[model samples]
Target: MDIKTASALHRLRLISVPEALSFPALLIFGSVLSRVSDIDFLMMPLGVLHGILFVIYGVMLLDVWVKAKWPFKKVLFFFVLSLIPFGGLYGDKVLKREEADSVVAARAREAAQA
Candidate 1:
């Protein structure tokens, strides 16, 4: 893959962490603290931030999926994974492993060519 295509994966992986956390943070602020804090004021901003991040993450994921030519099942799995709290950490790990494997494969190709 070209650097741009591969870098899309890296971008998606980076956004996954913040996007994952934002949802739970929204939940806690929106639901759990609905009664306890007067900071109900924070709810809208948190929700908006989460919404924006969620959309951005989805877009980045789509970009990566297309560039990487991932299977529908794999794309669906990652989409579902993003919905679960803290699932991004797991996703990050998986992406790292895949990145490592791709790097090794690319190196092997280069070695063979040389």
Candidate 2:
């Protein structure tokens, strides 16, 4: 992948954690916390924020899928992970390893060319 696409993937890796957290947080606030306290008002704002984060995640996911030529199954796996609580932690590690592997491959290519 090109530098821009790689950078986008890097950003997505970073966002995965927060996006993952937001889903659970939103659920807790809307379902459990809201009924017990006045913080119910906070649900709307949190939901909106989560929505924005999710959209950003989706956009980056699509961008990486296209640019990185990731397989459909891999793309779907990442998407499903975003839906599960704390799944981003595992995803981040996987993405980190993927990034490291790609970097190593790129360097090997350059060395071969040289």
Candidate 3:
């Protein structure tokens, strides 16, 4: 893949690790705090951030799905993985491996052409 494509995918892939983990943690914390006190205020920003990240993730998923032309099963796997805690970390690793392989293949093809 080209640098721009790789970079976009990587950014989304990396960001997902934290965002995925954060949502459940914040929700849990908010839920606990709500029982003790008010949490509507806290949830507002968190909800917005989650919404933005979700859109970014979905877009990146579509972008990479096309760029990589990944099988439907793999694409679905990444999407579902983003929802579970620590799953983003797993997805990042998988995507990184695929990206690396793509880069290597591109380089080899260029070398052959030269």
Candidate 4:
């Protein structure tokens, strides 16, 4: 991949793990807080933040999917993976492997050209 595409992929990969992890955490915390306290102030901000992150993650997922021209099965797998708690970490691991392989391939190509 070119630098810009690679950068975009990297950025999405970074955000995906944290956002995916955070959303479920906030959901659980908000649910618990709602039961225990009347003040439940944290829910609003956490909800909004999680919602925004969810949207961003979806958009980034689509962007990377198209840019990478991944198979539909792979795309679907990643989409589904985002829904489960801690699944993004697994996704990140897969992406990291792909990134490393791509970099090595790019280097090999460059060396061949030189």
Candidate 5:
């Protein structure tokens, strides 16, 4: 992959995990808070933030899949993983492994070309 694509993929990989975790956290917290108090209005902003992050995560997932030439199964796995609480941490681990492999492969390709 080109440097720009690699950079974008790396960034997306980093951001996605936190964003994924944040969504569920906000939901659970908001639900509990609503039951305990009258600060239910908090959920509105949290919901919007979560929604935006979800869309960004989805888009970035597709972008990384295409740019990295990921298999459909792998792509689907991450997509589903994002939906589950704490699954993003697992996804991050997987992405780290993939990133390492990709870096090595890119260097090898460069050496071969040179």
Candidate 6:
């Protein structure tokens, strides 16, 4: 809802997406095993990176949920969204739209109070 929350979520969303997508691509590459053992071994690293990024994504989602005090359904949707391919990107877009809406509402409230 706040700019800081929006900004942090934006970054987490960006980071997690590429990490998650890389996992399956790397796995596929490993399976292909095109004559290079080292290349095939990269799968382990990819899995590690994806795991870490996924944890970070979860943390970021929780941060946003707490800051925005969003309803349970919205929070659940956000968690579910992160599991799909490029889901983080979609989550980022949704969060940004919500952030913009919050900004507009804030401005309106200020005007009203004045």
Best by lDDT: 2
Task: Tell me the tens digit of each residue's lDDT in model 3 across 4-108.
Answer: 556667776767776677678776676677778965688767667777777888888888878766789988898888888768888888878776776777788
lDDT string, candidate 2, 16-63, tens digits: 989989888776768677888766777888889988988898988998
Model 3, runs deviating above 4 Å: 1-5
The residue-by-residue lDDT of candidate 4 on 1-114, one tens digit each, is: 644456657877888888877867887888788889885888888889888887888898888777777789998898888888888889889878777766676677788889
lDDT of 1 by residue, 1-114 (tens): 545655777888889899889888776758678678666777788888888988998999999888888899998988998999988878988887766666676677778889
lDDT of 2 at 31: 66
Q: Which candidate, 2 or 5, would have the higher TM-score against the true structure?
A: 5
Clashes of 6: 0
lDDT (tens digit, per residue) of candidate 5 on 2-113: 5655665687788778777886788788878998999889998888887887788888888897788889998899899888888888888877777777777788888999
lDDT of 3 at 75: 83
User: If both were scored by TM-score, which would come out higher, candidate 2 or candidate 3?
Assistant: 2
Poorest 10 consecutive residues by lDDT, candidate 4: 1-10
Per-model C-alpha lDDT, please? Answer: 0.82, 0.83, 0.76, 0.80, 0.81, 0.69
List the lowest-lDDT window of 10 residues for candidate 3. 1-10
Ranking by TM-score: 5, 4, 2, 1, 3, 6
Q: Weakest 10 consecutive residues, lDDT, candidate 6?
A: 34-43
Of 3 and 5, the candidate ranking higher by lDDT: 5
Order the candidates by lDDT, highest first.
Answer: 2, 1, 5, 4, 3, 6
Segments in model 2 whose C-alpha atoms lie over 4 Å from true places: 1-5
Q: Provide TM-scores for the models.
A: 0.86, 0.87, 0.83, 0.88, 0.89, 0.70
Error of 3 at 77 (Å): 0.6
